[model samples]
Each structure stands twice: as C-alpha cells, then as structure tokens.
Target: MTATIPLGSRISGERLAVLLGEWRRRGSRHGSTDLAAAVEMYVLDGQLPIGTRLPAERELAAALGVSRTLIGAALDRLREDGIVASRQGAGSWIAGTGARRRDLEIPVTDGIFDLAKAAPSALPGLTAAADAARHDLAAYVTGNGYVTGGLPSLRSRIAERYTARGLPTTEEQVMITGGAYSAFVLCLRMLAGPGDRVLVEQPTYPNALDALRAAHALPVPVALDPGEGWDLAGVEAALRQASPRFAYLMADFQNPTGHRLDAEQRERLGGLLARTRTPVVIDESLVELDYDSDPLDGPPPLASFAGELSLTLGSASKSHWGGLRLGWIRASADLLDRLLSSRFAVDLGAPVFEQLVLAAMLEPAGYAALAQRRQDFRGRRDALAAALGHYCPDWTFTMPSGGLSLWCRLPKPMSTRLAVSAANHGVQLAPGSRFGVHGGMERWLRVPFALPSEHLSEAVRRLSLAVASVRSCAGVPAVNVPVA
Candidate 1:
C-alpha cells in the first residue's frame, strides 16, 4: 500500500487554505474559475513551487468547506491552463516535470491535524502561573520595562536547572533571548559572517538552516542515521576540511532524528571540539522533554566538555509553552558578557511578563505539573508508534524515548508526495526534504506526537489513506533501497 518517492514537495489542503486567504472574490458568480485563478497567483508568487503536488479534490473541498464539484471544476480550469497536470491513476501536481522542492516557511493554522512542528500545547496550570506572575509583575511596574540580558530571577532559575542537569553554572553564564531562534541569530551575528562555513547535522532543524541562509553563512553538514549515531570521524574530517567558523550540534535529543549523545559520546565529542578549538552551538531546547529518565540525570551538557567553546541554547518553546517566547544561552562568562553587549543591536530584551511567567513555571515547587507533562508526552509517543504499526505496517520509524517526533524511514522514498497526499487526507506533515541541506531526503519523514493520543491515532489513520493515494500515483518503477 506504499509507493516510490516523488520529486516534488506536498502541501496539505488545510495549510493551502490558510495560504490562500480571502482568495474568493466577494459576491462573485464564477467561484470555480476564481479558485483556479487564485491558485495561479500562488504559483506565480512562488508560494506553490513548480512540481508541488495538490491534494485530492475531496480533501481540498473539505478543507475549504466547499462542494467537491467546485474543487473538481477548479482543477479542470487549472489543467486546461497548464497550471496543473494529472493522469487517471497518478494524482495532480503543479505542471512541470521536475522542480526543486520548496518548503513554505509558514505557521500552521489551528483545527487541522498539524504535525509540522514538534511543539505541544501549553502545560497545565499556565493560567494560574500567569495569575501568579501578575502579582510578581507589580514589583517591576515602577521601573522601566527594559532589562539587560534578562530578568535576573529567570536567569537564576534557568542556571539552577542547568546545574541540576550537570553543567554547573552561575547566573553570569546565561543570557535570555526572545526565543532559541533569536538566540542563534544573536550568536551567528556575533561570530561568522557572510561565506563562513558553519557545521551542522544533515537533517538538522529546518528553521536553523533558514537562519543560516538568511545570514549568508555556508552550512557544512554531517549526515545522521536515525538508527545509528554520529560519525565522530566524519565530524573531525569536516572540522578540518571545512574549517567552519562555528559548528552547531544538538547533543541532547537532536531534532528530526531524535538521537541523543550518551555520556561517553558526549565526552568524546566535547573533547574533539575542545581539541579543534571549534566553537559550537549546542541546541538543548528538547533536553528537558526526556521521557525515559529524569532530566536532572541526563548526560552532562556538551558545553561541559567544550568549555567556553560551546554556547548552549535553551528554550521554553518545547519544554514549557512556545507562546512565552523565552529561551536562554549558556556560554563562558566572558562570552556571555560579549553576547549581552552586542544583543541590543538585534533587540533590546525579552518581554518582562512572559519572563516572569516562565520563571514562575520553573520554580522548584512545580515539578508535579512538569512530571505530568512528560508522562503525557510519553503516552502520546507510544500511541503514535502503535498507530503506525496498526495502520501502515510497512512504514518504519525508530521510537523516540523523549522529544516529540518519530523520524520515519518510509517503505519507499515517497516523503514529498506523501506529504501532499497526507495533506489532502487531513494531515499536515514535516516532509523529509525540508530537513536536508540541499532538499533531497525523500526516503524519510519526521512525524511529531505533540498532539493528544487520540489525535495522533486518528492522524496516522489519515496518513494511511494518504499512503494509499501516493502508492496509486506511482507510475514509474519503485526504486528499491535495502531495509533492515
């Protein structure tokens, strides 16, 4: 029931509906033609890259809350204009033979089954914390809103957590930013400039790749096999050959592929980076979400080995709530001072209210809620793994002990096409290609279990339907890759 991979990227009907906001002309009679023309505008505007696959008509109709006939008529118009192409068995795609896959750098709309992000909803008692924070805010109201680095109290709380984990730290070693992404940008702007090589994992965070590109820094990648682990020899080679200005590595629960470096590996990698004198950015946003063991007992932070050479990025986005938009950086005191001095050029400081809210959430007394969150996430992870086993028996993925996603190795390289079909079937996906440096990991996909167990189960059921659609669309012979 699976198909070979397709070259193009896919968009879910729900995501597309969000992108095509207010596409219909008010009081217009010809809805189908108008719909076709709107899609043309998206193509022309480059929202829908060439070779992008469209969802099945039924899916689009459901997403748009329109009749299936309208969707069919719109497709008819699009096909006549050469805006779309389709065969009887193969599903429709944006008209073109081949096009480099384009990831729409956009947010997911609510109500659709969104698996594009690994973010879960706010932790329980967020409202009560905000209420507590309101009382705390009273102390700061008399003074001006801006604070350098971050609120001292929040930094202290974060430092305590880092110390608990293994990285002993004082408040001086940490600086807060708007979010982890902003923290990365602040470090990027500080270190390397245009054309400097930056080392990263092959299928690292997509937005991190986007940030690297935006800064005009060249990203040198080291491939990561989800089943296997980091190839330290290859990393050593890249450090030598690439001579990257700075390297970005996720030692704890690395994104996409939820691979964590064990204590031995961490010591080895830390020693390697320290020897090379290569500065690294260790993203620890998902470090706190480890389900199997206590976060306090996790391996020592990569920075522990690399010393001042490593700048660890911490975030509340995953561990707490993303809406708070609070994350921190841990570096050597000297480096933290330097980053703090230069941060104003980017923005003044993080918000006071959210900082207070997060600080409240992190208080030592709140472990019950935090423990409950991990328990819940672990349950959802198992549910998703079970759903895949039940619905798409051929599809394979390594079960992530912590973090939010399962990095799936498809039965075929149908990641891109499956994404589009999955969208049509009411599930949005983080396609495999979005993660690669050059956009071609068509055989893999990252499915997040951030939703509730029920949602995850239903989402996989829908994914099975999409998988069937993709299989039916494979006109070319399947390219066989060895499976374990």
Candidate 2:
C-alpha cells in the first residue's frame, strides 16, 4: 500500500467552521443532512477544491459547536454523495463535485474580479526606468554578470534607503535577492532547520508560513489582534517559552492586519529580542507604502531598535513592480556573509537586467513615480473602503493608514462560504482562514484594492450577493430525521 501524500493544504477545523456558516436550519431535525449540504455547497463551488484535506471529526465538532456524531454523520452523507473520500488513518479530502452541479443556479459573469492578492501593477514610469536600465546593461554585458552579494549600484541605493529609514545600514550589509520571499527563504535556510521553532504572528503572510514549513521549521505563533495591534507580553512569553531560533516579523503596515508597531512598541519588541538573545528576520516589504506620513517620518525601522540580530528584508514588489523581481536583505556584515555563502545552493544571482532595472528605479529620478504610486494606492484603498461601506454596511474595518488591502470583519463568520459563493458571482477572495496558523479567524476577510474603482465596486456588489446566497443556503430545510 502507498503512504498518503497530502491531498492539499489541510483545512483546519476552525477554518471549516468559517466555511460552513449557519449550516443548520433553526429547529431542523436532520442536522447531519444540513451540515452535509453546507459542506457540499463548498465542494460544488470549488471552494473546497479537489484534494483539499479536511479536519478530523472531533476537531470539526468542536469548531462547529456540535457533537462528533453530528460531524461523523455529515461526513457519511458527503461520502454517499461522492463528494468526499476518506481513509481510516489519512483523514478525508474533497474528492469530486458530486451529481448536483447541473441543478444549481450559479450566477453567470464574463470576468472574475480578483481580491485574492495584494499585489499592485507596476509603478508608473517603470517602462521608462527599464529603458534607462537597458542602456546601462551594456556596461555589464562584458562581465560574468554574477554579482553574488549584489551589484554595488543597487546595494548602495538600498543601503542609503536603510539610512533614511534610520537603520544606518552600509553597502556591505545588504544582499540583493530575487524578491522579498526569496530573501526570506535564504534567511530561513541559513538560520533554521527541521523541528526548530521560528516565532511568527498568528495571522501572518501565508507564504511565509509555507516557506517556514517547507524548510521544516516549526512556527510558534504569537496572537495578533487587528484592532489592538501586537501583544508584546504574549510575544515576550513565546520567546521565553518556545525559545524560537528566530522570529519573523512585519512591523510596518503588517499584512492582512494593517497594524503598524509604533516606535515605542518597536523599542519594546526590539528590547525583548535583545534580551532573549534571539535573532529575527523583519520583513519590511510594505514599509514604503505609508499613506499618512513620510516613510522616513514614521517609526524607525524595527532593525534600528532590534540591533545586530535583526535581518531586514525589503522589496520592489509592492513599491515598484513585481516583474522586476528584486529585493534585498540588510544584516550585520557577519550575518550577511553567512547568507551570501548559503546562496551557492540556490541559483547563481538575481537576473542582471532586472537588478539594473531596480537600480534605476531606486535612482533619485525615479522617486517621483514611487510617490505617485503611493498616491494611486491611497486612492484605491479609500475606494475599496467606500465600496465596502456602501455595499457591505455591516462589514467593519479600521481604515488602514497603509497597506494595499483592508482587513474587514464580516457580520457573519461566512468568509469561506462567501468566497465559494463569490466565485460563482465572478469575484475571488482570500478568506481570513488562510492567514491563521492553526486554522481560525472565520469572522474576517482581506480585500485588496488592486483593481480599478469600477471593478472594486462591482466585486463588492457581487460579494454582497454572495452573502445573500449564503443566507439562502442556511435557510434551506434538511430532510427530516429523528433527533438523537
């Protein structure tokens, strides 16, 4: 017999709860049937995409505030419908769409509105910068083109950037990489190993969690409240108890949460790391997108507070264009050496032309576009908030001072279900469950302002329809059965 390879990322019980909002009808006797139909809706809509693993029965019962018998019965119903498959030891997964597909009335639309990613289009003037870099590339054409550490031009620009942000970085401290995520991978490789505990925010950038797991590093989560911001006491305890090898943090306009660690908070957090003698990788990918104040006038980079133990990651993906595929790491000279030495196992170096393009983008002349990009994003951010207010009145969110997405708290814990229904309405979403480590946060959703205003408005309108559809699903009566 073959061992079970993972079907796909496991959907935690708490996450499944978010997907099965109000599954049972009031006073319905056949709760198992109701639960099964709710689960079936997700499967049919491709929300629980094929091969997606499901929570264990006991876990599901706890999450849904029901009994295991109810969950088991529901699973049985699902299996009968041919929508799910299970093995004794391997748990269960979505297997097929079942025979009900043709009967459902799925809303039709020509194009899908995507709010699943926070990435924006290339900064205006990227083409002009690329053209300038194209001419500059001729000089490097004569060389081997592998600047392992990074091209001096790009490194210096990034170094000065750190200085402006109050880190006092030098050219020697920075190592350019393919992107912020790549920079994270390189650091993860150098600092952690299998079974090692790496501290992280509870609802963090999902990709970072994936990378940490891929490296076999166990992530120790510290709870983060979107409204309240980081809980330093909790972080301090996790550091002391878990003794994580290092922490991964995003203090500036933190992803999905939009909570910035104020200067005082950073000082306190930095001191905690210093006292713990723990190293940290601070992902500053969203640092440049501040909407209210100058990025410089804001709190100093957390690295400045954290001292030598911090490894700071910066990227052009959010500020400029993702296509440039460029980011860099600022670390102590000694740590930078180790990260550089570890690069041999990966590809040679970041592509030469892209690096040059980023270099040109960082030039003094290119800052006008950066400012313009920020203005454009600020407008987009307000547009999304307005749409949400207009279309989803009960969906509450703090107006983020920065960041490309808004973290909205839904009136119902129907994020996953709403996502499935939204897909039918031609709108894509990243539900709150994707951000949590152990699978929860069902009451929330992250909506990006990356689309045009018209598109954003329409998407929210469709989302409002999806919300209604979910309500309709909850209202459908299940086949009668004797109550246990």
Clashing pairs in 1: 5-413
TM-score of each: 0.77, 0.77
Task: Show model 1 residue runs off by greater than 4 Å.
Answer: 1-110, 474-484
Clashes of 2: 0
Score candidate 1 by lDDT: 0.80
For residues 122-193, write the lDDT of model 1, one tens digit per residue: 988788899999999999999999987899999998898888888899998889899999999999998889
User: After aligning candidate 2 to the native by TM-score, how far in Å is the CA of 421 from where it should be?
Assistant: 1.5
Model 2 residue runs over 4 Å out of place are 1-110, 472-484
What is the C-alpha lDDT profile of model 2 across 289-345, one tens digit per residue?
999987878899888878788999999888887778888999999998888788999
